[model samples]
Target chain A: MENENMNKITINIGPVHPSTHGVLKFVVEIDQDTIKKVEPEIGFVHRGVEKMAEMKYFNSFMPIADKLDYISALNWEVLYATTIENALGITVPPRAVYIRTLMCEMQRMMSHLLFLAHVGEDLGNTTLFMWGFRERELLMDLTEEVSGGRLAPMYVSIGGLYYDLPEGFSEKLLSTLSVIESKVKNEYRAMSYENGLFKMRTVGVGIISREQILKYGITGPNIRASGIKRDLRKDEPYLAYDKIDFDVVTEKAGDAYARFMVRVNEILESIRMIRQVIKDMPTGDVKVKVPWIFKIPPKYTFVRQETPRGEAAMYLVTNDDQKPYRLKIRAPSFYTLQAVKELFVGSKVADLVAILGSLDPVPGEIDR
Target chain B: MESSDTIKGRFPTLLSDVPSTNKNETVILLNDKSKLKTVVGEIKNHFDILFMLMVVDKPPKVFEMNYVFTNYSKNDILTLRVNIDRNKPSVDSISNLLGSADWEEREVYDMFGISFKGHKDLRRILLPEDWPGRPLRKDFQVTDEVRNWTGLDLKF
Candidate 1:
């Protein structure tokens, strides 16, 4: 008789759903249109990069790291390179730092642009999806100009970049960024932010409080959207972030709408940082010469970087070997997905997609 | 500095006296695994966030578990390290205190076969169910079947 009261129907959402954004599957238990529990069953796309990192040389692992987060590949590359450089006590040139910083900001913008488009599409407002990608192409052009690749570009190296910035690259970037800035201001604001349908679908749904955020280890824009001023770039500045001035955007509502707004504002902030980086751009050698056989001393170091998604950390252990003894990737999405289990409880089934989109779990990084 | 002094003053028995290797970060290695929950609970009360949890395999019957906690207010990171027996690696789960540990503890169990005693659910995360052995272990050898599946003829 007691078991009859606990009759919750299980509904499998993904593993191949369009809204999942990747190969993420969720076994959501619902009781008549209301979600009782959501169990995210990931690992469908686990490539075991950590095990593979153990076999590759210190510098050879950069490409592997690039595959961790494809949307912001440069950031992952920079994170791995800096971790190795820090372990070896290699001082990156100021010019190189500025260049890396510029690229990172651009990458952040690129990621947030995608997030905006994705969330917009998820909420049935296709205007943002169309306009955001149109603006993102301009950023991609600058990316190709600097890194020589469109996506999955492993630009940052151990000592510095693969090469120095191209001549007149700053001018081109400035021009492109200004164009992007205009579109974001006029077009995106008029289309998505003010759209009535977009507001209704997102507002007051999938709400996450500050306590829930801390309990689940959710970070980046998601936590910031919950009204917590916890951006690693602000809390613990890295890669020229200390030199720049930008506000850590936050939204107190902690709902799907707030998360969307936070990323939208973050895109604007990234543009500001990119503009500052170009203005204060130092002049020097981008790439420094290092020994062919790069061997780090026996030590363990953990380095964290504020990626577009959240705080991504690399824990490296080297036993005086050419390759790392162990490499542990602390991806933000891993915990975010964990929090999804609780995010769906007591909400209408319609809110599941909005919550999933708002959380923004990159399955590649989460499953890595 | 205040947090470091406070931890040192409080857990004099559990924390090692050795100075931290990293300048700004504080690293403490706990000698006992039984008191992990107690010490971690105290740390959570001290810090605002649990930054990361990682397991390191120190071969020949020893595994080291590292829990990194951060005080966001002061921008300080405190890493707590605990060593357990490699033969049967298990520690008290901290997921109850820090909700973030739910997935991470499962991940450690999946890769290294190091289980968390009090965890509600412990299952293979990054690999398929019924997969032969823990792939992250030092003694884990690559099977020919896996190599064939990966399209590589190399064997370990």
Candidate 2:
């Protein structure tokens, strides 16, 4: 009888594959159940965001930044606006900084919560998806209450925020935080991390070493999971992250389970950060006194900050014009995605979904 | 610290003569081909992270490529720039040292038509497979193909 091991099969998990998520395609070389190699074929969701920004006015590009990381829309806008502000030498008001920081933490919570729900669904725990979305909806409601949009909250403007938090926003935020914290704790304990099946599926699976992570320029929880104490918020504090007290969560094991645990704990820390921002927020003008349209000086500037996913960086070049000469985004997902090459080299085909879920990549961010 | 200062002070001497600035960051201009790789290697050894790679098109036949590197441990940024003739613009690829340079180098190749020697995969990323000449060059004209895709009947 001929040996079955003689044959090698190649699978194209596509630009449209549900498991692959978004427009990313993976061409996997497999032998039976073991994956020999995984080649990531990107540029599917490339909408020419950088090219479009070159044509649009500097301030008008905030809405485009909102679309890049649509899952964490407010953070994306804040990063772009802050980069412009940094280039132009403007300082945002104290109250605006606190509000921006609060909303950023809220967005961080929602992003992590969505990741939990999606990871649960990927692992066949459907109830956790509902629980995750249910909690995420409360936070989305708070976003709408403050920014007037549920998803694409283009609230952070250059040098400040677009507007102040609405009346009773603080009370609503506090109540929502309490409910989310309890639900998250219960669901995480019952369905994720602590669950035997989750541990068995994720622990020791998709393990990436600290050396490999640093070599690949991986950041955020993925790097932290490898025992690297490099959270940009704590290391390079921006906005009100410096004022608000919080812990930088890290896990020594650098596995899928470690990445998941880091995010789960980060949600609780975000709640703490939000509570502090609300309590310590000072009274001042929310918007800076600047003209609606302004020309930036001729210079190049680079700015970066911690987003829910990782370090989102923006590089801007201005030619003393209303429109920017060039805009380049160093999205965190793009860097984290590099680890997939190292993660899936020797893993089973079935474990690909779990590994990808732990990465929690936003393709819009990757392509942009 | 003195060694770092010597290297920092000698940055301009290593490159083709252009005014150098060492404010919060060090910016060196290079126009010589022989010094490009060695200068880049020196910068990379000093700064671990290659932060940004950018190409700018100046009208009528000149393109400038800039490589920015930052040393997180030392809290300093170093920028090295090279000017290339538009007709035959080509430079050495640094992707072997900085893995992050892979995509950015390809992007520079795609937009400005400046080739990076030894690039493993030099295919167009953001543009379509059969797209024409580079788009960012001042003299390069936008084709009617893009206009047709926009669903507008306006003449190009």
Candidate 3:
């Protein structure tokens, strides 16, 4: 054992590696390029958002909530809003729910596009990254047209949305959606899916077994990729998801390629949901009247919503105070991060980036 | 959604009377924190995973630790809440039972200053290893030590 220890070496991969997506570090023990152990070192971006919630008012924390999953801001915003709404026993207007649903799907498209871009770049495909961002820009423009914020919209409020859909927003969105849909089906396939080199890097790179997934409580696309067929939206419908119809994309392989395919198919699914939401959205007040200063009675409310990365939950503890007594933001990435060791161990160093990118964990959410 | 009564009936000995909270969420406060291992171990048949371990600081009393478990096949969620005395501020680690409890327990230790009896690696997860005080505690004061934290002291 002592002699074996002398041959193994440990290397540190960034709290700031370009391909890490955010500030994530990995301490790896390697024996001739084969990983013996991978200890994921996170919390570089821990902003104490949960502690911040205790200081801020109930309604004032939306801005902080928006920053949790920076990639899919709307989903975090919606989850936070829904937790408060559920605690207060307030039902949002039908129109607002539809709008929230539509915006969330759009954010899903944005997030998944970024995932593709990041993963593509990781596998040495700069064009795929550019292509991913190119389509994502159209979404940023559309969301900006309505919400006026590119990354953190701050559009979602306690009762409903801050603003109604902008003029000609539907027409522009429909056109953009079709363009993305076609590009995703054709261009994305031509660039990565059909490319032999792409398959070589991803097809069997990092595989998460069903047992590892359940053991780590992995949710969302990461879980779906492992063939469990579990999605919070379909299992327990929240927001406008009950009315909208879509399939929960799943892949049996549970490898890096399957994870990629799952998110790619989810983009198409989101496009379908967006179209349904637009056609069926009822016209009504965007937001309900909420008092400037109101307190939610003492109660514990837990609201889990399906974000692009996975199932994100926000648990709110209120004590008849304007601010939450304790606010726990459960980012999907946090649980997914827990399984990094189980997933990465026994894999090659080259496939490390491939696996991490496939899971798509945002440190903002993980550290929060 | 099942109420606290239905869940309590499953584990009669150690489960105390706990109030029901929200739809699809049944909160059960355990009578003994030590029984947590057995309770979770027994219920592992129905629940597939321990989704999250949430710690709520209820000062002047104790820390209310909630273990959220989910049964994906049945589409059910159960929150097993245990009260740890503020003085002792410790509980049994369930990481061996459900693999996800490892980091969450470490997180609780990091934020709430709650120790796990048999946690294999119960170090600060989200904060620096030498982070001065538990920030999530209600009475935790931000002293000059926390104020002067440059993070440069972080060895890694």
- Which candidate wins on lDDT? 3
Two-chain DockQ for each candidate model:
0.67, 0.32, 0.81
What is the C-alpha lDDT profile of model 3 across A56-90, one tens digit per residue? 99888999999988889998899888898888888
Q: What is the TM-score of chain A in candidate 3?
A: 0.98
- After aligning candidate 1 to the native by TM-score, how far in Å is the CA of B59 from where it should be? 0.8
**Per-residue lDDT of B37-127 in model 1, one digit per residue for the tens?**
8888778777877878878899998898889887556778888888899988888998888988888888899999888988998898878
List, residue by residue over B30-108, the lDDT tens digit for candidate 3.
8788888888886676688888888988888899898888866766678888888998898899999888999989988
Segments in model 3 whose C-alpha atoms lie over 4 Å from true places: A1-3, B1-7, B143-148, B151-156
Worst 10 residues of 2 chain A by lDDT: A14-23
Candidate 3 shows a clash count of 0
Error of 1 at A115 (Å): 0.4
| C-alpha lDDT score of every prediction, in listed order | 0.85, 0.79, 0.88
Predicted candidate 2 versus true structure: per-residue lDDT over B11-112, tens digit per residue: 656564333322345666776755676776676667666666777776667777878776444545666778888778888887777777777787778777
The DockQ-derived docking category for candidate 2 is: acceptable
- Give the docking tier of candidate 3: high
**A191-245 per-residue lDDT for model 1 (tens digits):** 7777787788889988887777778778889988888888889878888999999
Model 2: DockQ vs. true structure: 0.32
Worst 10 residues of 1 chain B by lDDT: B146-155
lDDT of 2: 0.79
Which scores higher on DockQ, 2 or 3? Answer: 3
Per model, the share of native interface contacts recovered reads 0.72, 0.15, 0.89
